[model samples]
Target chain A: MSTQASPETVAPRDGGDGGVPEPSPTAGRSGPRQRRSGGWFVLPFAVCFGLFMLWPVVHGIAMSFTDESLTLAGTSFVGFDNYVEAFGDAAVWNALGNTLFFTLITTVPLVLIALGMALLVHTGLAGQWLWRLAFFAPYLLPVAVVTLIWQWVYQPDLGLANQLLNALGFGPVGWLSDEAVAMWAIALLTVWWTVGFNFLLYLAALQSLPDTLYEAAALDGAGAWRRLWSITLPQLRRTTVLVGMLQVLASLKVFDQIYILTKGGPNDSTRPILEYIYDVGFTGYRLGYASAISYLFFALIIVVSIAQLRFFPRQEG
Target chain B: MTGAHPRRHDRFTVDRRRFLRLSLTASGAALAPGLLTGCGAPAPGGDGVGLKIWDLFSGGDGLLMDEMMDTVRGGPDGFTLDRTILEWGPSYYTKLAMAAAGGRAPDVAVLHLSRMPGYAPGGLLDPFDLELLAEFGITREDFPPALWERAQWEGRLYAVPLDTHPFIVFYDLDVAERAGVLDGAGRLIQPGSPGAMLETSAALAEAHGGAGLLFGHVTDPAQNWRIFNALYAQTGAAFDLPESGPAIDTDAAVRVVSFLQELFDGRTNPNHLDYFGALASFTESRGAMIAVGEWELPTLRSTGIRLGAAPFVNVFGEPAVATDSHSYVLPRQERPDPARRREAHRYVAAMLRQSLTWAGAGHLPAYQPVLAEPGYAELDPQSSYTEAGDLAVLDPPAWFAGSGSLFQDRMSQAIQPALLGRASAEAAVDRMVRECADLLDQPNPVR
Candidate 1:
């Protein structure tokens, strides 16, 4: 069965099941002759991969069981003490709750808003190229730049946001000071900065959609909205799922925006788990405990990814 | 002319896309090592001939340090000074720790006085000799006893006192004049007591038609901790750590916390402005007074607003003010050179003698000689608040207790709800006591 569902599926026709496509029946008979060359070609990547990526993972897991500190000269084995401390630590729980709250508040809007933007731009908007560029431009900016822009925008008294509200006859809102509104303000900034990536993905999916389905629905006396509901929505299902899953993972690991915008402030209302881990590892100098918390978070990410895969098993043709 | 080698040349022609890819890969490979270390300089311990100093000063502080360095460089010390400015806070400490660990730390460095205990025990700092310091006319008696004691660890002096920057009250002179709170000399009259201070704030609030006293009580845990420390110091309470528990004065803690909560209850003092916002409100005349550190003196002075600064009044019945000092420390050297050590002492002494220049940047000089300089007594705001030097209440000595340490951050976070009116003052005090107990329970890894 083919795992390729989208029109631009990654699978090649002859290799739909696995491996490179066999151009002819005897293609595999010559595979051994090319295997050694392939191994030589992969040697440099494997070396670098082991040195930078694989070593850190293994070392981090080992350090999680010891009492390692960034500045201290020595460490001793502490078993699972750090993990136990984390389980009972209120700060950890508060940060975890904040992270999950941020994820929920951001993921749904990020997915739906990107879909809406893609549809609007794809509906023969004037200056098509400009619309595409504008929709996706924010994704290219550095996270620092995005947070800096929003920081000024969210300033309570003399900010542009309050000024806008004043013109609309609304009372000034404490965008960064109010604990209730601070995280939501960050979520709004996240949506504005990152919706561009998902928008581009949806736009690609929409462009690749076969026009024949819409034409057939049109012939059956369907209205424009009906055509969108019947043809466009269903065709975009796989991209929607992909976008949602990507957004959930991205939102779960949020650190940069919160670090710059709030530093988990207004009483830790916006503090996420990663910031907690950072505080432990770098700021607090408890590298071992920090590693344990991070590994726990890493395990959580893996479980979530597996659950997503089970729920949205790849469709095949 | 090259017809004979035409086929060979054609075989080596590169496409734009492939050439671009190759260039990117090459540049990235060349940049990887520097990116990993976060610095591009050749390794730290170089020759140890001239003074290799490290500091974390920027903006106004940076300007003052630059001026001082220029003076020292032109002096007859005849030794070169190589200065390295690191990003402040943990990043600076982390790099300093790593460099000391690698036996490549600079010859001289500046450290927060509160951090000395932590660094001293970890062997990241070297002890200074009293005889060497006295050769340059800087003796133990020339410093404030409270600050002088903080520069020691394990019965040895690990840091030399530089300057103390304390948390103080900055008031708008125009507003104070309107409220009739200023004396004949245009200085704010010291409130006799906490009750009197609250009345003064209320009167100022009525005159300004808004909150009178502004503080960064919303998100700045540091400021909240400073205020608490100041008030707690006034209660004459001490932090006593037993083997596995905290011995705190709960009554004093409750009293200070309750008083702070009332002070920021939105009638006399608004509790929501951040550090910058509070400063902005004071400068813009939206508020009559603000409580912050003297580091903001430059920003306030540049505003050209009618301003007056005073050491935090005896609001809690004592004139104590919370403060931290920046001092020179010698990072531990794997191999000590006598000549360099002597040079470091001379450099520190010269800097101390010129404390008048440093005072211009809004720091209270810890060196007693500078305070007696003929010109020092005439400096406007610095002289006005000179009493804070004697009144400075240093942070509690612990591995975690310091200006930017986790102790302040954690305690402030726990107590902020009371400031914001979300939690009862009693409950906030209880929470803080419990958190302090937990922190005390942790083993001192550095020790």
Candidate 2:
């Protein structure tokens, strides 16, 4: 996947040449004096990335070791104290617990269902463009828009969710009202709003699948389901693996969904880890603590992503 | 559904600090160049003397201040006003703290009096001199003493009382007339008991197409707890012991909690959240009454909703309503500046002097002179609750206390379940006391 996608795309054409020096190993071939000049190109970005992004990451790591806040004159470096405190805070654990549960509930079904949509649309079916448009339209909507729609739909009185329930002579689900049903309700909204993107990715991958494999499978008296299970699934494995990992990471940082619906809950039941980090940072004025939590989260995400990369040789195959 | 989506449109918000830091870094990046080329000015003086004022009073209050400042700046040349306008609520306080911590605070700012203690213990405020205040003609005798008490920290003045905005019970007078709740002056009469309130609420409910009496949900448990606090104050129930143990467990408090629980009709929640939601439906005459901050009156009036203001219900048969005062304060500056300080003082004085004009919008004036202004009593809603400032009830001063921070969040969290009928009132109050104990016990060693 990496090899196919790289495209050897250089940085933005002209590449920071607003009076900035050109950076290339070509300078080394030119001469020793010219080779030293390329350092200026690397210098500016290195300073910016180090200062803005990398420095904060390091500072956050350092802060995670301290039990200090911004109010104090000097942060007392109480080693591993914040982490211990964070673990004890039930709210933090609840957020993490909710985030993991939401991720598992949403990502698996979303990817598989999106895969089914991709397969159906990929087949020579009627109203091809209509199905594609219908499936892909919602993905273009913003998170706030999608959430707003769901918020109205999930409203208990005079809402479409309850209205639909009543119409079916079923019990009115407390979609975002009750603690028990809220996360799953948000997951359902997630499936509707974002399944399109995964579907598009899967469709693109399936389009690129070699026709010969399916034709060969068909020649052996393979029906639609058999062909899909053997040829189609194997062919789309790389895209599926990539999308699954990406979706898991995406779902873990679910802020806007939970924020709009339930707002971390009836009893902090719907709170996600990212929302907790945000609450700690901006809302509570604990930037030091929020940054520390964010970095810890970053490490966790990196570890999970690395584990995904471990599965890549087979994905490539 | 159309209007329900919060219209989120973003303009670029580059903060002054970040932008300054960016400019500084750019300038610093040019420092080597500046030293080499010698084109830059010297770095700004840390010891510079000038008046710095900060406040979160925007919209009409902001415009009035702007016009007032332009008049001041253009007036008899005595001093300069270095001003900063910060967005209000949580951001305002956070910025205030960060500025004080980084030692870049303004010399004058508006601090909600409820917030004084939190900043005070940290030495984030410079105590104002009574003698200095007397020269400015601000005497303790002139202002309401209860509000005046909110501005002091440790027997010293940290802030001057500017104005107080209390929750006034607003009713549709047209609906009230139908309910036969008329005073001798033909105004809406104030109810004085839990039963009288329910009776009046039932009357208002019947008059307004039988919609429930309250315009908002019990999810506003701070207001509910405040109702309890007022009742407890009347019945003499303390959440703390005569000196020990949590006393929210007291009998009077339990009765108050039960009484509040009874106010819910079992019909429905407001089907909305927050002030915006309540204010919207109230304007449409969906409900007959709402208890809300005075700041919302002008907005409601602008919606063409006729309103009558009364003191909140006297639950234990004594008048009590929660109030929070907004005062013009000086955020601490790192350096000393005499003249700039005087100008900041003059601006606060002038704003207070023009409090009648401020109240023309919505707020109740804290100044005695402003209250005595001719035709001050003629303003409809402002006149109605004008005396509410004279007898104010504020949240207890603590580091954890403010409008929507930990205290409100915890109080709201505990009581909202009971409002939903998910938890009993006893269970809700129990949860509140238990949680608040931990927060109260979370000591600030700095304090």
Candidate 3:
């Protein structure tokens, strides 16, 4: 994944400014000197990354093999016991299923709706600033603020949602209380809160597309829809892929909003795997088992990322 | 370069260096007091025995606690108290456990009596020095026997009981009067059986044009468990979870769940109110009565509604209401300072002695002397439910079963669906039993 960007950076340098300059003495010397200095520059981040991230990742794997607990009592190697139990654990499977479902529902709409909003805004609409601010403002709010706002909006009896429904001659819906509807409610709130980033990405991609192709198509009497399908969409494929990957990953890792809103409830219908792992490790005090479940989730995420990368290989210009 | 350019650059360097030095001195001056205080030398209230306390109290309860602490601060006991109020529930408990385990725990911390088994066995709490406590006029006889027994683990006192907050009935006096459910004494008529309770709720619902009884069973696991445990206990059923499995009478659980389902009938009680919603409904007089922990008393009183409170009535064969007590525990400390420990004991004793003030928030005082006070008897509505503390049935003792514990979460998951009509009562009971059995089958992490 890290290597994927190397070609793009190297390709631009090789092709775009080929005859710009012969290497000066300082420029030639900078290769080794900069490398030496860069080591110093990276030291602080490297140290932090090693301690906070790398060590935890390594220690967590080690702990997964033992019966470690938050109680700080005696711990003993349990070999494959925790993993074996997790594999057969109904709760783990249920949580994983919910997470995947959330990812699917949130990702598709986040991508499509963002693209639609970006295209709408890019069409030289009036009140463009207002549209942009309204579209992107939710993303600026913190998770706690976002959940608090949505919780009131999703209230069953007195909330705006049900009031609107009632005005339409429909009965009140239990947005956060009904098991079947709870996840959808969370997904809806999440889309509202985070779709802005994707929208901005799409809008940037749209703005950057060369106008020559569209102009030529227009000269040949191509309709707006025809031009959009042939030029605009194809030009924005990379952005779509980027947004889809990011949205899927973000949705998969969702915890804060759902935790604050439902605590994954109406019967654990909205509980993602991360919350389950949290409940097990912290609330249940079974840290070892939680670590095992976390590693399992980690492996699943790696497989998903690899599959996505393989399917949507990034195109280097 | 010209000579003038070098002098100009030198002057700029001197000015920048001076500016850096001045800013450094300014920041250092600003941070000095904070750094000194952080090192624990000169305490905030100088020359007093400083004691750090951690509590999970917020909203009405938090304000009352603060007032009580202020009284103690101004009392004859020259103790400086530093209290850290944290969010209630798992976040508080988890942080307290970690702090205790790390040997940097506060001098004293508030813990629910139901959580004693989990914390004590894990060595996160140090047993109280009973002799030291007795010096301050607190003894085993000071608290009710059942509550006192719960404050111990393996025959050692790990907590000093403060107050027992129980699930009691709160009613709108005006609504009850209009519905003709009030007795001659202006008290809520006791509903002796499930049928009678439903009848009362129906009448009240008609009077109020909304739900008669609001339980807030939706999306609130702790409340659901409290209501279920209270009703289930009334059936006089023995509930025991051994390694083999749950030995509960399944019929009793099913009956409790079914009764809850009926009570939450859309007209009699709203089916989709969370905890705050129920509080709002009752406050707004939309609901004639609400069944919840008495901690909501302050919120209800502030709304200026004519409110009446009563102990939970006997709906089954026996009388019971789910309850848990707030108690002070000494979080485990390595190489504990003797003077500070004694101060903690003194502080806890003082808090218990002055618990009549705490009772203003609707928690029944566990201190016998406080309960016997004329002031306590005079506390309207609060005094009306004193019997609930006696009839209190706490969450069955287990490592996982307690207020804000995973057991409550599991119970909520098992029973919420039934309450919502998505599952049958029998299915809910089965799920509860199966989940209990699963928890019991696992290794006790605390040990």
Candidate 4:
């Protein structure tokens, strides 16, 4: 697959105005000759991908038009009925709203905090190794471990959060149970657990910037904040857009933490659309309905991803 | 009639034999991946039958089941059981359903009684033959009437019940005694009415430095439903089912929700404790009472806290308790071999006969012989609530109604806000009614 597709992948390169350096012009000559012999190499992966990933995507779409159930043997098509029901379903709307709200809540914090941590760590702080390790460690932990740790921390009665709050002369808060606070609690855990990935991204982007830019800014009679605004901020704009796009997509798919901590309640206050789809498909045995709702979510994600690409337009180097 | 085709049979017999051999080879080819991958172990081919069984039992229950398997291993019957333990709840059921649908389900699996309606109606389970079971020394008379009834669908038995775990009240015996809510024999003084139960909670809270009765309704709607169902059962209010939808007694629901809200007002009962948190609170002696199902028995017992069991408080008028049962079911297979089916039945019979061993985990055995065992009456908490078996009020027969089902989750969502004083009891009940109606209105594909 790589050999056959490599030519098409490289064909557009020749049309570009010298963006990529040509290490060897003769290297492309052998590509077509290897294509036929290499097909077998990709067979195994193609079979696996076809069976596991591609098949489910196709099967799920096919199922969305019917009244298929997990337990029932026979399925009959009822064109658009499941989709129609999803559109009218209040729970579906509630879950979608909650998911969007959660994305909005966490995306901003995740991006900003990650950038902040990256900047702080990049400034050559006294304990650079400790700061880097501390900022990136939580992401290395499994989601279940993160949720379990935070569950104890958020325990209403004797959790670490409440204990600390009480000692500070504040009242105990129902972090996992209160409808108003539950999603925020989940968002906070998510930020703490996941900001590491975004932080690492920003850190890499920060390190890759040439030191001469900062030196030139310093020579222009600028302060630290001015250097950051004029040079550092402008240089980091591409990474910021990339990080924001990734973070938004990740936040929209939140399920594990909420499932582990709240199971989408205190009254479905924290139930994101993925959980609602799980409930519909698996718990309710309405596979067709779940598929329809999922397809709707899939379409939304595609639209959002496309919209982001259009808005950002990949800054030209 | 036997010899009618004798003249033409020689060719037919040869053709039939050839067809059988061809199909067998084809099937072997189909099953090659399953044989190669360690997804599941192949049946041991020998004189003895190899039975594949799946269950979701873990922790104490898993240990007890393991002991029962050890006993089964030594039985006279030449049967070997290959056990697979899956994660409990929706995932377990989903895998079972998927395997059944694909015609590769295990010979036997454990199922919650409430899940039977969902599985049985969809051809996911096979009905048990009483006569076949009778040969193994098991009969209908061995189980309680309610459990036996629950195990059957359309007058055919689909599951052999292991035990019934009813919703019961567990109190910290030491705390209750200190609060003067215990009788002379160290048993909880039964609350004759809802008010009396609240008073007991109040007294216990005062004794425990203002910590009240703990129930895990904070986030789990299913737990909340168990408490609400038990309370509603006491009110003599039953759901009226019509083709259109379920007509629940709103008045009863409103009263029950309000009473629960009052209980969780944080004066006598803390309003914010989840399932595990509430159990920890009770064991830690911060709470005097916990209104939960019998499954939590082993957990409570392990706390080493002196605990006593009582019936769910009758807030309305009668002593009705919400309950669910665990039972053995044979998931339907595309081609079920008679040898394996017979072995599965024998295994179930053996498990049922050893219900006393199962009873140690705090489940009230559906097997009547276990109850009649001389030593069973000596079991502290089990004996204390054996009467709850007769009073068990099961979830209404709906595909959506069961442990870990969406019905319970939605109900909990509706009621939790009220329990936390975030929403009015009236609003909660209204939401519950609306959700129940929506669920009922949806077409049951299994039907």
Candidate 5:
């Protein structure tokens, strides 16, 4: 069904400006008036953005400079002290390392496994709808529900994972308790829960690939494997880049599942930077220090994003 | 172009206008009940004294508290109780702090006595009127001196003592009998010392064909700290937090950690068990005994297991156990209502009088009168550990030391490696001293 509709959907993008209809002759004369009317329509969104997003950013930056706390205690301006302390904080460094390690482990598998699933589904597998649904269903679940299910599965003794391993003559493993294995277990669950979104992206990219290229490749005696390597993979390059970037950014921000699962325990091995901020701010009652650490993390994310953009510059038509 | 489809456009515009009107009317109809209800309910209690109480009680304790609240609601005092049960731990405390800071806190809330120093000094809680409490028949004399003193800050009473929940031992009666560890009165014969405790555990292990004791040492920092504190306290070591650092006795701390290592050597007790796992092990008969807080009494009883409980045995020179109390505190209010404050005091007094019902869940009541009652002593297993209240060793007074506080978290982190056999007991003690120094170096954020 998607095959017949692909050409019509793909035509506009490949054709670029050629696919555009000519503007009305009076458009230039009425443009300012139309723009004025459009401003009214955008005003509500502009107000919301300024209030919620812009205000918090400005306020948080201001808060990072003081000795603010959760107790509404007296505050003092401690110029650069919080930041200096954060730089010297060993816990902050440890949490950041854990976050980086998690991003490294989860991103590669999430991207590759998603692509494999999409490729299988795009090959006209029988019951296309079922395969697509099965691939995408886990992404629809809330993180709480996902963690609840995985918590049971990861239980050391009576859990299904160990039961299966025991049946196979292997000893029980502490999936959530052993310091060495906790992060890997959390990463595995995260991959299972979120690989669906990436799969859907890849599937759409696969479906939208032009059929004429495949036809030409087949005419040149290209087998399925060669076609996949020489044509399909290269065609999906932009999609792959997008998927990889999104996966890394998403993985770095991980907190909910790990927080619910282990509270970053078995000696804080799985604690991410975000959980550290939460612990310092709410649990430890040190909001100003938490804010400084937050800005440091924010700066790190920006640098990583800029590097990604520079290395994989967007493809222009 | 405008005139070409003028008639059809006119009809479409009219239909769109009608649809908008109809949709608006439909939405208004849908919202009518909610709007009415929002304004219709009379201030919750219709001129009666309404007390909003927040507590962190769940499991068997939650059910018992619910029953107590129900009785108060139905009593002749004409008091209406609005209760909220929050999740126990940092989340609950965080929300309470935020609410109190914002001046929108509940009339009364539960606060750990150990946490009183943090909150009371910060003015997050208002001092209670002793005369008012006395009017309600709750006096300072009614509580243990240590608990009452801990509930005060800067010479004013900020909390009313509730119950002291200490680290205790739960054993399967049948398993203990099979292992011949019970005494003449069916009480668990005291292990008395570390070596004797290990010997008894070995015997129990032989009888049960599994770990003799189930101590949840994995991933549960609170449990780790509780057991450590209880054992360390038994050493008669002085623990004080000074500005320089935690004044923990190094040799005593190492001794306790070494004993824990031997206890969790994978035979006497499984080192990998977690909170729920320990409960399961004890209930499933895989372990002869489990060492945990007395709070698990009702849960174990529900499983239909033949259970018995005793106070934490003396493993060193002194008989001491780490304990904390769940007390009632009046959170600071922007505009304190005299009548509502009075009602809160009454509610707490009423709850204290009903301590026997609370005792069923295994906490020793702080109200001394309740302990003297015939009914309290009749409670099996619960009454067995009444001495724990006197032997209680609360977390040392510090801004960061309390149940679910940062001090406990730090202690747990430092000691967990040793418990897991990844670090030496001496090294773990060093880490503990260093971490406590770090905490001491951090400026007190609670003011």
Candidate 6:
């Protein structure tokens, strides 16, 4: 039963059930190990993981309950006050809108382009390494460097983009400078900077697909586009779901690029949720409120992740 | 070795909601709340009771500060030092606020003078005790009367005065003479009146080739707001009648906005950004005259560009300029001992005297005695515009108003539209007022 089917649904078999394993009274450590005397083995990692991740999450969760600040010594447990305030916060909705806007703009197109690049490079394309290298080289640059390079490119005056625009005698558009264009500008930057990773995943998936399906499709005269839509996509269903979820999660949490490039500016037009949390947590000095926003954000992300997980519903052999 | 089954003592700790809800179900401060985040490792040397200091100064100024700190460290002071340097802008304020709120705070720090008032009444800072401050050679007499006045809160000082770094108009003398905008003394023409400024700027623009309007530094709106504030002050307009709330809709602000708007007329530069290298080059016959802080004077001089410095053109009537003061502050320590506090005070004193040196970093020292010293009186741009302080100008006292740089946020929102001629002066002024109201409405409790 454990060998043939699902990885997700392994249930605990209780005593007396045919599947239940008999508990051995003395098989486990009744000695020093049983006493857990060597718990020190896990001590180092437990301390680190607890301190860094577990601690902040708990702290943030608690902070959401009060009128908390970095300035105040004592916090008043102003029940639901933080949530109530957030409900009224225009920035909350604005940031949500910006984040959602970014996700919509980048996610679909990223999957498509990444898949396209992968299919191109995977189907016995000439210069495959060069193409893969070209696609993958960008993903290796850290987020900050990617943002800096893209920022220079997107700069209104003296930027490559505007320089091209003016050279053509067209108007010099404020790519990142204009309020209406800022989000799109950032989304575009995000696509360029991140598509490489998704591309690589797609390429790997494409390579792993059996040649038999494509051979059959070719014999049946299924066009390249037809094969991609029918054979390639179905074969890549799992990879597609994984990549989509990863991009969605990563996109929702985007901070560094926006911070470096737009700084959520031109009237906070580019403000992202993470940036807002940073602002409220650090800048506004309203840690409690910031924590509320963060947890709300985390909850939102978790809900989305769960929905995606169930929506994809991985298939079993 | 003594580690238990490591059932993770930290995890499964009291949840915040459970705790807060418990307190709400029960009462306030009944239980001590340790709602802090990600306390990764205990700080290096966490147990030694070292004094921690945080600051956001970089470049030459940062180097100077480090040297000063080095001097303190090498001194016979008895305290061990732990320092953290944070990045500037919004990030800086956010971290500072978090550290302060989280209670694992630095023992000493620095804040802009204009920014301290906002922090005070909120009780983010433990106000400096006058008697304690006096023990450091800092008294009301040590700084200018007006600056000393700004440093106080409810008649008590919260931030000790450090230095005033105000904006100065940088002009290249060589380019000015070539553009025929220079005085007989080889200095760039000193425009005392608004009309003179426009005329000089126009001539320079024509001679240099142009964006024919005053270059508004849109990226740095805090400076822009100060520009408006100075003009408003010249017209006897205050930014806020705290009693009546922030009053940006006043006629004075409108007039200031209109005057600023008019600078975008074709006769002047309409570029929405200021480039120093461009302006310095222009002053050196590369571009044209530009308004910048006196800090750039050294760069201009080193460029071998002849330079001139002055208060921003007085738009409403009187000569007014945007000014801000930097100050050293002592944050509260958890377990304060007399000796460590005394050493911290010693560091403060040395810093204050060292401020004259800090002045060379383009600030006019707040310590007035430095002004009388030959070194200061002879200082270039500081000496030229030092008087801007007496009748001087500054941004409104708001937590949102200083180098953490949110000061630029809405003011740019308000003024950039007008300066770009997107909104008329009246509408822009109204918008600015509304934004101010909105900002005031933010119930951001200070840490």
**In candidate 1, which residue pairs get closer than 3 Å at backbone N, Cα or C atoms, i.e. clash?**
none
Where does model 4 exceed 4 Å of error? A1-28, A314-317, B1-49, B210-212, B240-242
The Cα error of candidate 4 at residue B167, in Å, is 1.6
* TM-score to true structure, per model: 0.88, 0.81, 0.90, 0.90, 0.89, 0.82
The models' CA-based lDDT, in order, is 0.76, 0.65, 0.81, 0.79, 0.81, 0.65
The positional error of residue B165 in candidate 3, measured at the CA in angstroms, is 0.4
Point out where model 3 deviates above 4 Å.
A1-33, A314-317, B1-49
Number of the candidate with higher TM-score, 2 or 6: 6
Q: What is the TM-score of chain A in candidate 2?
A: 0.83
Clashes of 1: 0
In angstroms, how far off is A175's CA in candidate 5? Answer: 2.7
The runs of at least 3 residues in candidate 6 whose Cα sits more than 4 Å from the true structure, single-residue gaps closed, are A1-55, A221-223, A314-317, B1-53, B67-84, B98-107, B129-136, B180-195, B211-216, B219-221, B241-244, B265-267, B274-286, B297-302, B405-407
lDDT of 5 by residue, B149-230 (tens): 8887889999998899998998888878999988999988888899999988998898888879898766665888898898
**Per-residue accuracy of model 4 over B42-105 as CA lDDT, tens digit each:** 4433345368888988878899989988888894664587888987777677777777766678
Local lDDT at A1 for model 1: 12
* Model 6, C-alpha of B229: deviation from truth (Å): 2.7
Top DockQ hit: 6
Residue B228, candidate 5: C-alpha displacement in angstroms: 0.1
